[model samples]
Target: MDSQNSMRWLNVIANIGVLIGLLSVLFQMKQDQELLRVTLTNDYYTSYITADTSFAGESLPAIWEKALLDPKNLSLKEMRIMESQTFAPINRWINLYRLSEAGIVNESFWKSQVNLDAGYYLGDSYGRAYWEVSKEDWDDGFLPKELRDHIDKTLLNRKLNETLAYY
Candidate 1:
């Protein structure tokens, strides 16, 4: 082949190599992003599980049972026990909110979990009293707006559907 034709063919192969390199870098970046998402989700999941299992560690079930029956009737020690139980889950929620703010966790998933938990925990009068007391301990900006709103809605529903006390 003439020198001109040979040079043109070499240039084409070099361009193809550059394109391949760019594509591979893009692929690597996508994989890295996915791995980061999974790692963040796993961290949040571990925190959630720890918060739930903390009840066993703190011996909260008996106290929680009593508090549920009549929060107004709890002694100072029992109130403290309830307060301690409240903090673990709230701390996990704070961590989750931070992760959501950092864009490390999925906002929609966090929102759903927040709503679900609010429905379960704030479904009655005792939980509302516990929250009123325990919430004073949290720093400003710890709970996200979505979670706060969910709690508000749950409490409102509970008030609207008030049932006679069986205590």
Candidate 2:
């Protein structure tokens, strides 16, 4: 009877060992699956955020008019950002940046007026916004030629014609 009892105890121990081995294999498989998932997620994100190759590290200098006439002179990064962006009311500065690169937008250009509707439409829905420029930004050559000519000719002459002359 003692021998029989000893044999039963050994069988129970063997069964426990087999169960532990199976659990170990399961755990290892779970770990591998987790690792694979992480790798795939990382690969997807890496492909998503593409970097602009052109003007990646370029700076927009203040000489804006010169920059506009020579867009090819810009770095790839600058071109990419400008091409992709849409201007907003807050990004008045960005409009200036794009204008610098736009090459030609008529010879006589004016800064933004106080009203929001005072700007021109750019390609795509992204309007190139302007600032409500003070009188300081307005200079001799800035206003459109027709408007300037009319102001000088009509308004100035109106004043001259009002002056008294000897009959």
Candidate 3:
């Protein structure tokens, strides 16, 4: 009878140990997720800074302004530069969107980012022109359908005559 009692106590202790081990693993996973979020946020800002530095040349700003104002007048080389410059931020937004969809990044943060940049990058005339030119390429199964739909909705909702005062 005493041995039966000892076995029951041992079983209870073993179950508690297993429960504690699982909780510890869950706690560690949560910490890792938080660390990943911090690292990704830092990387996003770093990439934004790097993209801005690409326009540091003296002639580039004028070219960009020209691209924004009169895209039709730009030479092929200027058009390519404008396309590359414009795509950088759009690509970052796409990645952030994917991360948000995956639950890796908070949806609120992603929404804030899109709210801040989508108007300038997708709503403005230059942005619209870029999209009109490049959107066919995006339909080749590389971009997710939901993101494409979201971009389309943003374009449809944006004011065509919207202008940035600072530019």
Candidate 4:
């Protein structure tokens, strides 16, 4: 072939090689994302199992139940137990929040989990009290914003109702 034809063929080959390289990088990125998602999901399940067993296998559940029923009557030790009970699920929430923020978890899944746990956690007066006290200990943006806003509204509503009840 002439030198001009040879140079044209080389240019086409270089473009094809660049395209192949780009496709390979895209495939690798997709694979990495899938792996990250699976890892996050597995971590979430492990956390859930730990929390489930901790609540079921020992006296922790009973203690927490009693405190939830009569939060005002708890001794210091019982209060501390309640605090730890509260932290268990909240820690899961923080992990899930991190996963969601990183795009490892989808928005719908994260919202469902948050809503489910909030129903259980916010149902108890002691849970609400613990949230109020411990919230400051968490980093400002660590928890999901919607979850924090819901708790803020719930606490405000409780305070308002209490004030009105005094009249």
**How many steric overlaps are in each model, in order?**
0, 8, 0, 0
Error of 2 at 137 (Å): 56
lDDT of 4 by residue, 18-98 (tens): 999999999999999999899878888798787667655466767766765677888887787667667877777677767
Task: Give the winner by lDDT.
Answer: 3
Q: TM-scores of all models? A: 0.67, 0.31, 0.88, 0.78
Best by TM-score: 3
Give the per-residue lDDT of model 3 (tens digit) for 11-113: 9999999999999999999999889888998899898889878765786788777866776788887777777777877788778877787778987776667
Instruction: Write the candidate numbers in order of decreasing lDDT.
Output: 3, 4, 1, 2
> Residue 70: error of model 3 in Å?
1.5
Q: Is candidate 3 or candidate 4 better by lDDT?
A: 3
lDDT of 2 at 155: 31
Error of 1 at 95 (Å): 2.7
> What is every candidate's alpha-carbon RMSD to the true fold?
4.3, 22.9, 2.0, 5.5
- The TM-score measured for candidate 3 stands at 0.88
Q: Ten-residue segment with the worst summed lDDT in candidate 3?
A: 158-167
On TM-score, the stronger of 3 and 4 is 3
How much is 65 displaced in model 3, in angstroms? 1.1
